[model samples]
Target: MAPKVTVLDYGAGNVRSAVRALEHVGAEVKLSRDPQDIREADGLLVPGVGAYAAVMDALKASGSLRHLGYRIAGGRATMGICVGHQVFFEAGVEHGVRTEGLGEWPGVVERLPAPVVPHMGWNTVQAPEGSRLFEGIEDERFYFVHSYGVLEWNFDVTQPAMRPPLVTWAEHGAPFIAAVENGSLSATQFHPEKSGDAGAALLKNWMGTF
Candidate 1:
């Protein structure tokens, strides 16, 4: 059976493309904001496109915040994209406005220190060793459209027996997180749904983890 993946529909933007992308990757996709679906699916995809504060408001307004926390705390498989990926951090500061995020990791989302603001278009990422998501597409470029990002990563597993998260990096004017694979949680700063063939292969690789 295909992996049951639920796409969180918290009114971020047009998520039909993400739905189509997941389906193309052989996932049994379901579009919903239901807490039950969020918890029970084999994988949950949190997708977003827009400002950081607005995305958090939508997630809170729809009562997805707690359930998402619950899902992640339980170590279930979850993936975030774009602003969805941004909200995994402790906070995001956009245009002088500071908004709290899910705090899944210790970091702050700030404006990219780049001559070009949005960091739009195709760019290659330096995937860490042992990354399952970039298995076949390690050298390929993926689509990105964002201004704010976690410029630094400070989260660490203090225990000697635990493995550190695999972080992928890409640069505009300075290096920023491109993607992260931390145990049951994974996320990307780019839109796999819009990345054409390379993106499809990435989605396929993620589904393999399910």
Candidate 2:
């Protein structure tokens, strides 16, 4: 069966590009705000741009946030790109605004402490020991354009409820969370859709999970 992927536009820009990338990886893609379609989707992709609070606001207003949480909680595959990935954390603090995230992982999304803001361009990532996300393309670089990221994975590894996500890290001024794989939930701080061939491989690997 062809992979069915849903790309969400929660008031963030550049969705058509994401849809195009997903399509390039041989997945049947749809851009939607309808809760039913999002809930029933084989894979839910939350793509975002702009501030954390703004993305959260649009997600709440879209009425799909609840469905997103429900579907992921039920062990359905879901992917978040860029700010979409940040919103899956506990909270994000941008310009003094504290926005609550989906809280699927233990961490805070805050600004990168780099000499340059908006750490843009292609960079290499330190993939986890055994990650399905970076599966055969570990040496390839990915595109990143963001100022905020979760600097560390903060969770009690001893606790079963606090299942630590398989995390990938990258460096700008310092190391930060790049991608995370938690069971049916996966996210990337970098824009896979914009990262060229390596991005395509990552997307293909993700789709192959279905």
lDDT tens readout by residue for model 1, 123-210:
9999988999999899999999999899899877786977788999999988999999989999999999999999999998888887
Candidate 2: segments with Cα more than 4 A from true spot: 161-163
Error of 2 at 99 (Å): 1.2
| Model 2 C-alpha lDDT per residue in residues 113-193, reported as the tens digit of each score | 999989999999999888998999899999999999999787778986766779999999889999999989999999999
Please estimate how well model 2 matches the true structure, expressed as its whole-model Cα lDDT: 0.90
Model 1 regions more than 4 Å off: 157-161
TM-score for candidate 2:
0.97
Which candidate number maximizes lDDT?
1
* Model 2: how far residue 148 lies from native, Å: 0.8
Worst 10 residues of 2 by lDDT: 154-163
Error of 2 at 57 (Å): 0.5
Candidate 2, RMSD to the unseen true structure: 1.1
Score candidate 1 by lDDT: 0.93
